[model samples]
Target chain A: MENREELKQLIARIKGGNTDQFGVIIERYQKLVAHVVFKMVTTEADREDVCQEVFVKVYQKLDSFRFQSKLSTWIATIAYNTSLNYLEKKRVPLLDDVAPQESPLERIAAEDNTPDETAEYKDLSALLIEEIDRLPVQYGTILALYHLEDMSYKEISQITRIPDGTVKSHIFRARKLLKDRLLAKYKQEDLCR
Target chain B: MSIKHLSDKRIQEYLDNKLRPESLSPDERKHLDSCQLCQGTMADYSHLYSGLAQEERQLLSPHFTARTMAIIRALEKPATAISRSSLFIAFVAVVTICGVVNYFINIKDILYAVEAFSLERLLSGSAFVSTMEQWSSRLGGNLNILVFAGLLLILVGLIDKLLVRQKANRAYFMSV
Candidate 1:
């Protein structure tokens, strides 16, 4: 609460045209912004670029902020919208509609002969990352927020502007799809053996 | 007991710990404990959970924070600078336009006085003709040149004003 008050004061200063105060806000929320952006964009390079764009937008629109939500929520919202705009500009297709069943896990498992080995686990982790990359933007986003960032469902709902139930459903479906893919990979590896 | 009857979704919920342990009916726990297939499925899910837990906390390179901050700073500097320049340019444009319009409106009164003086009739007709001819030969050419030059100056000023405006517009919208 004390921090929130300080943030509001800083935001007031920023909106009043002290742009250096805006830098303080950026310094504070940079990690949260980067994490959100990283989940949406594919490459490290793009994520870095997008994170900057998000902050730039936040800085430009500082005066318009009505203080209806938390500063972090506002920043995350900007991060989310900026990433979407970046994706749209890049002509990248949305991830939700296509239900590609083929899992990257299958490919990784096929390449490895050893089961339950650390190398196999590492390969599985890599496969998970690839599969996450392939997930629809919405699914990928929720998974990242929930699993990677350890955000609560309520927080995710706030960030996503989706209902909590909807967030849960998407997460459930995403996990099921991921599991099916991994299990199928394991079976295929067995057949090869 | 057909383990096949258990829904993938229900098993997932159990594995995720989303289901309240207190809310689970006795039959559900019994099935989970007794059924090898269900137990095996739970084990697989636990393994997957552990794997995800281990993998999710990936940190970027050590320089990632510095690099991201740098890019953000770069993007922000240009954006704010551009917006500030545009606001300044817009302020100048409004002032200039107001000044030009004021000048034209004030000059219109003087032009009206000149036209009214030119419309007066001659007092002596023959004398007037001679006078008119003299005026036309000497002052008329000079007047023509002066008026033409004045109009040209006004036109050039307006055009220059417009060009400045266009440059500001281009800089504001195009460069960034």
Candidate 2:
């Protein structure tokens, strides 16, 4: 059966008082939830705590889940809102500096052959993520949903509760801004070198 | 087809494949193909897209799954316990309702028996009537005491309910 169907079955069982079935559901979507949460929160610690809270809320409100969207989408929405709540509680500034840790591309560069592999696509990935991080929260969110998460506009609309037209507009603006920022970064890097 | 100005936003839409090729007028396509700036912009975006695709595959920390599972287990325990407790509370409520209904129905017969004994004494003689009169006056005094006691109990219950409601409101605000 499809993964969604399998998840629905597990959810049904969990709601029917079979708590053990929840373990399977958790195992299946854990990474997906963690990734989404990590994208929203600043620190690893906050991400961990919020991820736990999201699941707690999920279990507590499992009976109320209407299955209007896929389980993953619902979980992502929860993760997004939970991280936002965490930010609100901490009074952290929005659209702040990107996390100071090495970008994922940089981490990947550190793991393998350096000079030869670097020729493939030098600083593009890091530049793209930086530009995306600089975008407004709504724009950044839509870009993440579209490019990173591979969700359709309809799915993004459902998760974000935005109109499809707005989703399209945000994505359009996000990509334009990313393109400008990347080009500017490339020019600056060239000038620096 | 004449060359028309293409907005930067439209260039982005074209790069992301959000704009259908058929939707672009012939002049727009011609400009896209011939304009060096737009072409260069498209190449840069394409390269960025390809690089992002590769980076997207990097899995999160190895322990991510384990940590998430631990959380889910912890959360599920409390949730299951809560559901079970709510079910138990519902069961208790149903039993209490049944017990109350049963007592009201069964207790009526005992009440009638007591009334029958009182009526029999009244029908016997004048002495019984005088005794009943005294007893009734004593009962009237006791009933006054009981009515005052009942009002006091109701007042206490109302105060308790008000205090509980105040506490609940405070707790709710604090949680928010």
Candidate 3:
């Protein structure tokens, strides 16, 4: 997290035609941008393109930044919007709810080659990642920003343009969804271990 | 008083440390401390929280920053080459030249001169079209200069186009 004075100095230098300084900003925030882009975009090539596009846009639009929010929040907001636009262009669904055809865990189980394969793998973290990927785009994005990036609901709301209360609700629902999916797939003892 | 098991929300909140110790009721705390089921649920959520924090971030290629900087550098070169001030100056020069030309040969006068030949007379072939004849004779002398200026403008436009396309190509190559 960059303080206001540090961010101002960095941005001032970049706007003063020292574009190399912008690389520093990119290095610092690429992980933040990647978190949002990776969750929203599934393809590797497209993800790389969108990530590059996000930084390019940030540099181009840096002059208009009013510093109303943390630079990270602003950068995350750009990443989120750029990813959404890419998805829109690709005609991918940005539906908020999980598809009703099957429960998320059940869907994951069905995809496995063997019913006991997940248990045999014994890597709950990897299993959770798979489950998260199966969620709706919005849920996956919220989870990544909230947990991986350690963003607060308010910061996420600002980034996603969701209401603060709705952001909290989404986080709660997304977590419960993950927990339910994991619990349904494995015994309590197996998961607790 | 009998205390039911902890709800999932309560367990989650507890795991998140959102429920402070003082906030927990005596019965709830006692039950949570003693109950195996609630404890197991807490362990599962704790596992989830830590896993998320420790999840590996997907990284861009190692050359990502260098590639992006190259694109920015390419973009900036064209931008510095053709500045807003230069474009504004060119625009002002065109407008000034047009204004000066308009002052000397008023388009309104030309239109008025054309209207002088009434349609009725022209249809009847009785009119000599003196007004149009006078304007054409006047325009004929300046036609060479006008053509020269028009060609000059076209050449400038083509040069601008080529420069822009070249800049675009350079940037595209850098991005690759």
Which DockQ-derived CAPRI band holds candidate 1? incorrect
Worst 10 residues of 3 chain A by lDDT: A184-193
DockQ winner between candidates 1 and 2: 2
lDDT-sorted candidate list, best first: 3, 1, 2
What are the runs in model 1 whose C-alpha is more than 4 Å off? A1-3, A16-18, A43-45, A96-98, A101-121, A187-193, B1-5, B15-20, B53-176
Model 3 agreement with the true structure over A1-193: per-residue lDDT tens digits: 6888988999999999899999999899999998899889977778887988899999999999999888889999999999999999988786656534877455655665453555554677777777788677888888889888888888999999999988877777778788878777675335334
TM-score of every prediction relative to native: 0.63, 0.61, 0.76
Residue pairs with colliding backbones in model 1 are A95-A136
Please report, as a residue range, the 10-residue window in candidate 2 chain A with the lowest summed lDDT: A113-122
For candidate 2, lDDT tens digit of each residue in A1-193? 1276767787889888787676676666666666666666756556666766777677878887887777778877887778778778877654453342654335444545444443433457665665665555556666767776677899888877789998888777666666655665554444334
Instruction: Show where candidate 3 strays beyond 4 Å.
Output: A115-121, A187-193, B1-3, B81-156, B159-174
Sort order, DockQ high to low: 3, 2, 1
Q: Best-fitting candidate, measured by lDDT?
A: 3
Candidate 1 TM-score, true structure as reference: 0.63
**Higher-lDDT candidate among 2 and 3?**
3
Q: What C-alpha lDDT values do all the predictions have?
A: 0.65, 0.62, 0.78
Per-residue lDDT of model 1, residues A85-112, tens digit only: 8888877665654466545555555556
